[model samples]
Target: MTYHRITSIDDRYFKPFHQLLQTIFPPEEVLEYELWREPIQDPAIYVYAALDGEEVVGATEYRYYKELRVAMTDFTIIGKASMGIGRFLMRNREQHLEQIMKDSGTVSLGMFAEIYDPYRAGIHSFGGVSPMNPIVRREVLSHMGYKRLELTYVHPSWDHEGAAVSELDLCFLPQNEELSELPALLIVSFLTGYYEALPNKPEAWHAMIEQLKTKETVKLAPL
Candidate 1:
């Protein structure tokens, strides 16, 4: 398996990356190909893909907040399970972010992800309901040291005008005390046994967390 950062949509891995997304999300939930391609071009966005001999099996995208020093996982999809591709892509993204911090003389307080609530199903246009399947993705994330922070918020739906029914869970790793004041259920993982649960913890995992702690604390915008 090979893992690399995607800098451009034309970077040879674009087609498979696009296909992987199409295969995962429903038609209405997926963005138009052109529209989706735009974010990958933005320098602030980081896209990583996992390939098994040239076939893109998994892809993860993140948006970096320079001022906040936070990297948010915007979306991640894995075409196959139990291959360990998801974990590979996540660790790669974290390493990439760490390098960015080192180059900029900043520190990343934590990595975060917002996922649709797996328990709920959305109403479909054909009168049938479409269930949200975030279980597999959530499991992979939890194993990677990300704890589910009790920050639940309703994300307004784009498909249904003026309706905000999508509930999302906000999760983060190496929790900070400052985050607890933000009116969210903050869960932190004690690195001890958690790493043992992972298939293989990245060599830099512990060092990276220590480096992150030395940086300035993340300031939360008033809620």
Candidate 2:
């Protein structure tokens, strides 16, 4: 199998990625995004796509957040893919990251991931799914312990054809609640499965990021 990693959404192959996401979600619901990246000695985020021929058969996204520096995370996947690819990429990147955290005495893989099974109805993967990512599902927030978290929802507005073209900032605050991290919400939203959004559903994802944060408290020495 041939695997491709995307650092910039503007890459020629990224067109396929956009097509996949746009096809899955209505124009309004889907995010019109750009893949802007900066050069880093050790890359933190990677979007992997595998192709049998020239078509994208499987894909997954991963990241290494500042807070959870030790462990690398891969959660979101599109098309027919599995945990193995995700795990492979993460494990490969973890070697360097884990060592850094160990030297700093902040061991224990600090991966922020919710279990998922991709074969399920929607957005489920690996083990399970995160219910209603920040902007993905709004009504299900309070039930899952997530506060309104300030202005975080973007309402997708459709064009005359109703095919969905652009999005407008819709202030969706459940109630008076404190805001979480500032800029990290977008990055955190990725880990929360915000990309797999569907309209008019109870919950595309049954799982939600609740009690856990770090991949591990202390990194155990490699055997």
Candidate 3:
């Protein structure tokens, strides 16, 4: 199996990969297929897949904010680790992002991910026989060295008509081991731009950003 980066929406595996995400995640968690089309051409956005003989088995997506020098791990779906593809794709993705930084002569502060709060998120069946347990997912990510940020995180609405999603935790994998804390303003800035780029946002989005403004620092804790 090989890892493939989808730089164009025309890639044959692009649609299939989106279909796979729809199968595994609920509507709120997965972006619409058409939404993937525009970002595919943006240098800041990245989408990749693990393929076995042209058949996509797993995929990951992320974005880099050049000004912030940070990357966000938006979505990833790698099945059971027993298959080893999960680890492979993850390591490759990190390396790819590092390469991007190197080519640009810039260094990333860290990579961020938003994970469901296991206790609060409950179980998501996604029409599958086996439901997804956030607890298990958290454990898996914890083993990979992702540390949860200590903050009241509420996901902004994905679109104008959507409501804010709660029970989510922001996780970070820092570029430097000695780095332990980040200024609250960094997160506030990133989130402000994040929401503004969306089609529309609700009051909760504004409230969350306002709350972040009152914090001096955002600390990280073991997941």
User: Candidates' lDDT values, in order?
Assistant: 0.57, 0.38, 0.77
Q: How accurate is candidate 1 locally (lDDT)?
A: 0.57
Q: Which stretches of candidate 2 lie over 4 Å from their true place?
A: 25-30, 35-42, 70-74, 81-108, 114-223
What TM-score does structure 1 among the candidates reach?
0.66
* Model 2: how far residue 162 lies from native, Å: 21
lDDT per residue for candidate 3 within 1-223, as digits (tens), equals 7888898768898888878787777677666777767768876778889887877777888887878998888877764335666677778988888888888788899888988776787777543522134666678787877888888777755533557788789888787756788888999888776655575666776787888899899898888
What C-alpha lDDT, on a 0 to 100 scale, does residue 13 get in candidate 3? Answer: 89
> Whole-model lDDT for model 2 versus the true structure?
0.38
For candidate 2, the TM-score is: 0.39
Predicted candidate 2 versus true structure: per-residue lDDT over 15-59, tens digit per residue: 786576555443443345642334211255566666556776445
Please report, as a residue range, the 10-residue window in candidate 3 with the lowest summed lDDT.
Answer: 125-134
Every model's TM-score = 0.66, 0.39, 0.89
Ranking by lDDT: 3, 1, 2
RMSD values for the candidates in order, in angstroms, are 12.6, 13.1, 2.3
